[model samples]
Target: MALYNKRINDQLMTNCLALSNELLEKETHSFFPNIMSYWNHILFGDLILLRRLALNHIAGLTPQTLSALPTPKSPQDIYCRKLSDFAHLRSQVDELIIQYCTNLTDENCEQFISYTTTEGESITKVIADLTQHIFNHQAHHRGQLTCVLSQFGVNYGCMDLPIIVSEGSRANA
Candidate 1:
C-alpha cells in the first residue's frame, strides 16, 4: 500500500509540476472548475481521512491529537488553495500516509473506525476498507485530472501501475 501510494504521489507531483501556473489555474470544462481545484480536493480528502484514522487510536497511525491534523475551514476552502500551496501540503500528507500504512498491522487494519460525517451522519467501517477507499478516491480524481490535462494537450504518460513498476525496475537495473 505504501509503495502504491508512493507511485501515485510521484505521478501526481510530476504531472502537476510540469504545468505552468497559468495552465494550472485555467478553468476545465468538467465538474471541477480547474486543475487547481481538483488537486486541492485530493489533498483535502486525504487530510480528512488521515484525521479520521488518527482519531481511531490505531497505534502508530494515531497522531498526538486530532488538532494536529490539517483541517480545511470547509470543503469549498479546499478549492481555494493555490496550486503550489496545495502541492506542498499534498507532499506532506502523502508522506504521512505512506508512513502510517507502512506501520499498520493486520490487527490494526481489521479494527473498525466510527466517525460522524460533515452532514452529521454517523458511520462505522473497517479500517482496511476505508484505507482502500482513500486510494480509490485518489485514482478517481486522477482520472479526471488526466482528462483535464489531455484537453490542454498535456501528456502525463503511462499511469498504469504495472508499467510504472517495469519502468522503475529497468531504471534500477
Candidate 2:
C-alpha cells in the first residue's frame, strides 16, 4: 500500500535520526577516531543529498557521471553539523511527503520527477526508483557505520528496519 510504504519511509527516516544520535553518543567512547569520522561523513553526505532532493532537484546526479565526495577529516565537528542539517532536511522531507502523499495516485508513484543534481549533471528517474535509492543509500552507509561501531565493540542494537518497525509500532506507528 502507498500509505504503508510512506509510513515505512517515515519510520526509516526516524530510525536514521535515532541511529545517528545513538552513534554520536557511542562515538564519544570510540577507540577509532578515523572510523568515527568516516561514519559521520556517510550520514552527513546522505543528509546533504536528501536536502538536495528536497529542493525538487534531480534527486541525485553528479556533475560528472561519477561524483567523488571528499574525504572526512574530523568526526565531532562533522557529526554535529550534519545533525543540524539532517534535522532541518528531515523536517522538510516529512512535510513534503505528507503534503503530496495524498495526491500521489497510482500513476504518480511511477511518475518521474526530473531535475538536475547540484553537480550540474542531469538525471531523470521514477519516484519509486529514487525513493528506493534513498533508503538503500542510507542502509549502505549505516552498514559501514555498524562495522565501525562493531570494531570498537559498540553494538548497534536495533539498527535494522524490521527492528525499527516493530519498535515504531509501539511508539509512533
Candidate 3:
C-alpha cells in the first residue's frame, strides 16, 4: 500500500508540474471546478486523516507533525492559485503519508480511530479502514480530474498500479 501510494503521488506531482498554469486553473463542470481544486482537496483529505491518526498518540505509530495542519473549511479554502505551490505542497504531504504508512504496524492498523466529521458528526473506525478510505477518496477525485483533463485534451497518462509495479520490476531486472 505504501509503495502504491508513493508511486501514484509521484505521478500526480509530475503531471501537475507538466501542466500549464492556465490548464491547471481551467474551470470545469465537475463537482470540483478545476484541476487545482481536486489537487487541493486530495491534500486536505490526507492531512485530516493524518491528524486523526496522530490522535492515537502511540509512540512511533503516529504522524507527529499533523497537529499543526490547518483544517480546511472547504475544498475551495485549500486551493492554491499557483501550480508550483500546489505541487510542492502535494509532494511534501505525500512524503508524510508514505512515512506514516511505512511506519504503521499490524497492531496499530487494527486500532480504532475516533473523530468528529467536519459536519460535527462523531464516527469511529479501524485505522486500516480509514487509511484505505483516504486512498480511495483520492482516486475518486483523481478520476474526476482526468475527466476534466480529457475535456481539455490533456492526457495525464497511465495511473494503473499494476503497470507501475511491472515497470518497476522490469527496471530492477
Candidate 4:
C-alpha cells in the first residue's frame, strides 16, 4: 500500500512540476485555494500522523529520526511555499513511509497508538488502522488534487493499484 501510494504521489508530483509557478500557485478559488496548497496539506498531514506513529519507535523509526521534519502548527500550515521545495520534502516523507512500512510486523500493527489530534483531542487507535488511514488520507486528497489538476487539463494517467502493479509486473517479465 505504501509503495503504490508512493508511485501515485510521484506521478502527481511530476504533473505539478510540469506546471509553471504561476499556475501551480494560481488561485483555484476552491477549498485549498491552489495546487501548492493541496500539496502542502497532504505533506503536512502525513508528517503529523507519521510523527505520532513514530513515537513508538517501531521498526527503528524513532521520533528523533523524524525530528528534522518540519512540525506544522496546524492542518493549514504551509511549510513549503513553493512546489519545488514541497517536492523535496515530499520525496523524503515518501521514503520514510516506505521504510517504515517495510519493517512493520503483524505484532507492530496490533499495537495501540495514543496521540493527540491537531485539535488537541486525545485519541487511541490500533496501529494497523492508523497505517491504513495514512494511505487512505493520501488517496482522498490526491483525488481532490487530480480533480483540480483536471480543471487545468492535466492527465495523471491510471492510478488504480492493480493496474500499476500489473504494468510493473509486465515490465519486469
Candidate 5:
C-alpha cells in the first residue's frame, strides 16, 4: 500500500506540475486555503509519520534518512513556498518513503510505535495501521487537491490504481 500510494502521489504531483503558477497558488477558501498548502501538508504528514517509523531504527530508515527531513513546528508550516521547489523536495521524501516501505519486515509491522503528535499528545499505534494511515492521509489530501483542480476545470487524467497495476502486469507478461 505504501509503494502504491507513492505511485499515485507521483502521478498526482505530475499533474500538479503541469498547472500554472497562478492556479497552483490560487486561494480556494478550502480547509487548506490553497493547492500548495494541501501539497505541503501532505508532505509534512508523510515526513512526520515516517520519522516516527524511523524511531524504531527499522530498515531503510537510517539515521542518514532521518537527518534529511526538516524539523517543522506544525503541519501547516510552509516548508516549500513554491510548487517547483516542493516537487524537488517531494521527490526526495517520496524516495525515502519508498525505501522504508520496501525494507519493512513482517516483524516490524507487528511492533507498536509510540510518538508525540503536533498537538503535544503522546500516542501509541501498531506499525501496520500507522503505515496505512500515512498513505490514507495522502489520499485524503490528494482528493481535496483533485477537487480544487476540478473546480478550475483542469483535467488531471485518470487516478485509478488499476492503471498502475495493469501497466506493471503488462510489463511483466
Candidate 6:
C-alpha cells in the first residue's frame, strides 16, 4: 500500500512539474498567476494537514491553514517563486508517507483521521482516502492550468498515470 501511494506521490509531483515547465517554455506566465495561487494555497494546506496528522493534532488547524497562505502581488512572480516551494512540499509529503508507512499494517488502511476542515466542518476520513484526495486535488488544478495554457496556444504534455511511473520521477539533482 505504501509503495502504491509513494508512486502516486512521485507521479503527481512529476506531472505537476512537467506541466508547469511546459507553461514556462511557452511564456504562459499570464495564464499561470491565478491557478498558481490556488495551487500553492492547496499545497500549503496539504502540508498543514500532514503536519497535524504527524503529531495527531487534528483539531484547531483549519483556521491556521486558512490564515497562513502566502499572498503574492504578481502572478508571474508567484509562478517563479512557488515551484521551488512546491518541490519542497512534495518532499515533505514523501517524508510523511515514509513515516506513516512504517507504522502501517493492512488493518490500518482505514485509520481514522478526524479534523476541522478549512470550511469549519468537522471531518472524519480514512488516511487512504485523504492521501488520494491530495493527489486528486493536485491533478484538478493542474487541469485548470492546462486549460489556461491551451488558451495561450501552448500545450501541456501527457499527464496520464502510466506516463508518470514509466518515465520515473527520480529525485532531480
Relative to the true structure, how large is the alpha-carbon lDDT of every model?
0.75, 0.47, 0.74, 0.86, 0.81, 0.53
| Tens-digit lDDT track of model 2 for 23-99 | 55455333335443544554454444444344553323323311233222332336434444444444444444344
Per-residue accuracy of model 6 over 117-150 as CA lDDT, tens digit each: 6556798888667756655665566566667656
Q: Over the full model, what C-alpha lDDT does candidate 4 score relative to the true structure?
A: 0.86
Which scores better on lDDT, 4 or 6? 4
Total residue pair clashes for candidate 1 = 0
lDDT of 4 by residue, 63-91 (tens): 88798899767889888878888888898
Candidate 5's residue-wise lDDT over 1-173, tens digit each? Answer: 55567677777788888889888888988878888999889988888887887777866675567786786668888888788888878888877877777788899888897888999999999888888888889989888888988998878778777775453456555
In model 1, which runs have C-alpha deviations exceeding 4 angstroms? 65-69, 166-173
Error of 3 at 166 (Å): 4.4
> What's each prediction's TM-score?
0.85, 0.48, 0.85, 0.92, 0.90, 0.54
Q: What lDDT tens digits, residue by residue, belong to model 1 across residues 141-168? A: 8899889988899877777776665534
As a whole number from 0 to 100, the lDDT of residue 155 in candidate 3 is 65
Instruction: Write the residue-wise lDDT of candidate 3 on 17-129 in tens digits.
Output: 88888877777978887788888888778777777777785325345475445655654566477878777667777777777777778888888878888889899899889
Instruction: Give stretches of model 6 more than 4 Å off.
Output: 1-33, 57-104, 167-173
Better of 1 and 5 by TM-score: 5
Backbone clashes, candidate 4: 0
Task: Itemize residue pairs with steric clashes in candidate 6.
Answer: none
Prediction 3 global C-alpha lDDT: 0.74
